[model samples]
Target: MPTAPCLQTILALVPRKRAFAASNCRHASLTGGTTIIQAGQIAWVRSACPAGSGPCIFRVLPLHRDGFSIPVTDTPAGNRGARRGSGGITLDDVARLAGVSAITVSRALNTPERVSPDTREKVRLAVEHTGYVPNLLAGGLASNRSRLVAALVPTIAGPVFLETIEALTDALARRGYQLMLGQSGYGESREDALIDAIVGRRPDGIVLTGIMRSEGGRRRLLASGIPVVETWDLTPTPVDMLVGFSHEQVGEVAARFLMDKGYRRPAVVTGDDHRAIQRRTGFERAFAERGIHGVPVFTVPAPTTLGSGREALRALRLAHPELDVLACSSDVLAHGAIVEAHAEGLSVPRDIAVMGFGDLAFARDAHPAITTVRIDGTGIGRQAAAFIADRAEGRAFGQKVVDIGFSLVERASA
Candidate 1:
């Protein structure tokens, strides 16, 4: 005998027909791997039964659509999310456990303001007993505000953005808001997928690490109606508000710092990030303004590590041994460069002056202590939090754009 085909293959074997007569609407139970495609009630129900279990009949609730709907393989939450007998925990389960009505449980959890103190206590205990986590996506319909804020960062590998993140988390928590963090990496493409998920969560506000560069990402943010705060990069036209420094200004200042130190042969060791590149651009432009040309630049993968910084210096040395200044995109990279310089028997500042960005904790601790560009990362975070909270609370800010500005920390390295 031929092997049994999967339900998907079986469904493909059936002929498409329109509007079965009421008598012909015979019930058919579906088991795991069993799927049926029917007109009018175009629901793709999945059996909770273990795979290869025998077929069992199920009665589906009425599904109505005014017109053609895109084929749905999964049921929408609004239709089945509240169904009491689906085995998943529902409001009814909590109510039954708490010896209260379903409405009471909902009121206790979502609108505690309207529920009695004693009833709220009972619902809370029941929820804790059942280990039930409310589906915030469903509960969002009643509350309108999820009381959640989302923060997007390029990477969390290094401490480059730790100050800002810590501040944002604490600030939001103080305002009765929770922070939902998403790492988009250094690539713009990763942001699109993250934005889609964040928008679906219906967060009260969104805090982004850098300004959104992609058109699709910006459009989705604008459509979300959530307050947005773009941090760490300056832009006049933001999705909502901006609290950051000018990467261009940082780069120019980095160049000027090295130049003032009497170092003319400068090279920048940078990660391939949008803001880092902007800083590099500014650095080179400053050089060009002083009739200096072709400043050497080495770019490594973003959220750069010490190893990449070491490799960058070696590569730069091979190309230009006369290169004197190493402008690193991050403190970790700067630390790497300093180590590599010592290994190469080059004296810091005398042979190769190292400069770093972010002014991370380790920057000052390194031997010869790195000179770096310091931005008030925590300040930016606090201000961004304020902007988001105020916007969520329907309060207007005095300024929609904030340029926290950057500082060049003069240390022993340069």
Candidate 2:
């Protein structure tokens, strides 16, 4: 939401220093040192990382009063032949073991099409035998690109994000950027680690699943120059850019839908995540407008499974026996609620109406056909890709903040 500082302003803020900034830094991974402008990207030269490097990377801390910061390299002196960055296998070692040139190894790893099948197979076998990992930072340094983007999601096991991931993957691939995924789980600690790791890698862009809520995390993101896209939820004060819908709006519409259907004792089954809570707030506020109060919420862990859904229903049933409708934060939760209804000898929509968010692939296929709120996840994916690609390629585009929006999918369940 805050205006990002201009590049020149940022550059002016940090003073030029000859010495490395500090020692005993803890962060993840490496980005090649030395930067230049090319191909519409801020290309950088990647410095070498010897095996058993003392530290993986340096971080950009809060700007000092001097308006300058020093970035440090990771590799320690000596033992260069034994290890690379992160003390892992180096490409040179792989080339040596494979009886091929390092260039051939790079071609085999980065662009196998440029190498003969026989040579590719040889490099592949050598890679397998040596456990040699390609340092993408080196390649990025050489080519003046870390043609990578990182997407941080709560959990990869959930189906709600799969569509966006698939679409985003395809779209970015067409533009020559590889996707690096990180699972932030369900809390701040995970987010902190992921942020440090991601920014350290110097990814061209970062795509987050929801608005960053933690103060420390938000500050960290704002400090970096990388382009970011926050998806699945919206906020006027996004870290950089955003592509999502309003959770409160979904909740209000869903709650009203149930009320319009004449279901009075409606309860919500929600995952215990930030966005889910916002949707629940909207749901509660809308019901309050209709003179409804004390609407119960059964909360469960994130990446809600069918079992959790069923269990949530059972728990709610004990407390609110007269409940006739179940609204969920995700289709997966709704699906579980339907299964539990059958267990209670209740017929969906007849004995109980159900509504869910996220019109997942299986929503329509469910026995009672889930009625849910639908967001244009594919559209979000495509636009997010464009946002990153356009920025990385130095193309100007309007509207850094985008609300791809959502829809209501009415079905038999509701």
Candidate 3:
């Protein structure tokens, strides 16, 4: 008898229709020297016979979209049998283990809030057991959506942004989207690098902590056509949408509040961040309008801490003991100033009044309940999420810029 043809020769002889007739075929055992090619719900098998035995055979089999199994095939001496490598664990594996659909598994991972607690726990356990890592890039390419939003903040250590971040995360989860956070530091270079990395990933949306300051970063954002939301700072000309209050207005109001309370000799202890400087300028301008020019200012590095605040207050007192009131850039700094004043036996409000920005929790729980400027951080976060979701979902929205504004909270410290 003639030797059996090689696998490639047999494939060449078979017609494309017969080789790919997956619907007409039934499941069969695969023998030695068999190679399987899978495409969607179809599989093509090529089985080679021994020399002088019989002609090679080709078969098609229908398979579940999620998975399939192949038996180990023994090869003749000095001949390597064709084999398929295990493709690793996948979403379908987790779904099968959890007794749910693949889409349900995906929903549980991306938006657990949409699924019941029990179902979510099942999917979670399945994922944990199988070590299934979601291929977001593949899914995103197929569906044209990553269902992910990227957010950049100046610093994660600052308590002032905690409310906004929490609100953003909650709102996004409710809408079946996830948030990826990045720290842009307090410099242009770091922000620009982060923007570049974020843009390359092509997220559904981007949330920025402040208005884009770098010209290159602004240009990239405008060119990328991604929905952008600038938060915590205001600008008439934003790259896309904006939800923030004016830092200048916050400072001016703090200054006027002290002036109204009969604290005439007022000075400032502020961080050197961009927003802090803007507030300081506003404070000085307000006092300058009343011929009170040259207000004493003590500056600390960005991300001001309690130690810096204490040092600032001490230094300001030594230079201008007449300064009866002090305005601080953050509640952390103001809290320090209050502690230092008490340490020096100076009575709060009576001896040295102190005001702080970002009415954080410590401001309310302080010894004298610090007077401070209150910005609606949660409101900004929710509004920003809404803006990004609307744009991502192709909903028409008229508002591009929103000023959440700020308020003065007077307490015992002032």
Best by TM-score: 3
Q: How high is the lDDT of residue 18 in model 2?
A: 21
Stretches of candidate 3 above 4 Å error? 1-87, 92-133
Q: Across residues 1-414, which tens digit of lDDT does each residue of candidate 3 receive?
A: 444332211111122233232221112232343354433222333433443433333322222222322221222222354322233456765777688898999889876888999999999877665557888899899878888999999899989998999999999988878999999988999999999999999999999998899999999999999999999999889999999999998888888888888888988998988999999999999989877888999999989899998999899999999989999999999999999999989999899999999999889999899999999999999999999999999999898999999889989999
lDDT of each: 0.77, 0.78, 0.80
lDDT of candidate 3 at residue 174, scale 0 to 100 = 81
Best by lDDT: 3
- For model 1, the stretches where C-alpha displacement exceeds 4 angstroms are 1-135
Ranking by TM-score: 3, 1, 2
Candidate 2 lDDT by residue in tens digits, 1-414: 322211110111122332222222222233433433221122122333333333233322222234333222333334343233343446665676567998999988878899999999989876765446677777899976698999998888888888899899999998878999999998989898899999988898999999898888888888988899999888979998889999999899888888898888989899899999999999999999999999999989887889988998899989988989999999999999899989999899888888888999999999899999998889989989999999998999999888887889999999
How much is the lDDT of residue 126 in candidate 3? 72
Model 1: how far is 253 from its true place, Å?
1.3
After superposition on all C-alphas, the RMSD of every candidate to the true structure, in Å, is: 12.7, 17.7, 9.9
Ranking by lDDT: 3, 2, 1
Q: Comparing 1 and 3 by TM-score, which wins?
A: 3
Clashes of 2: 13
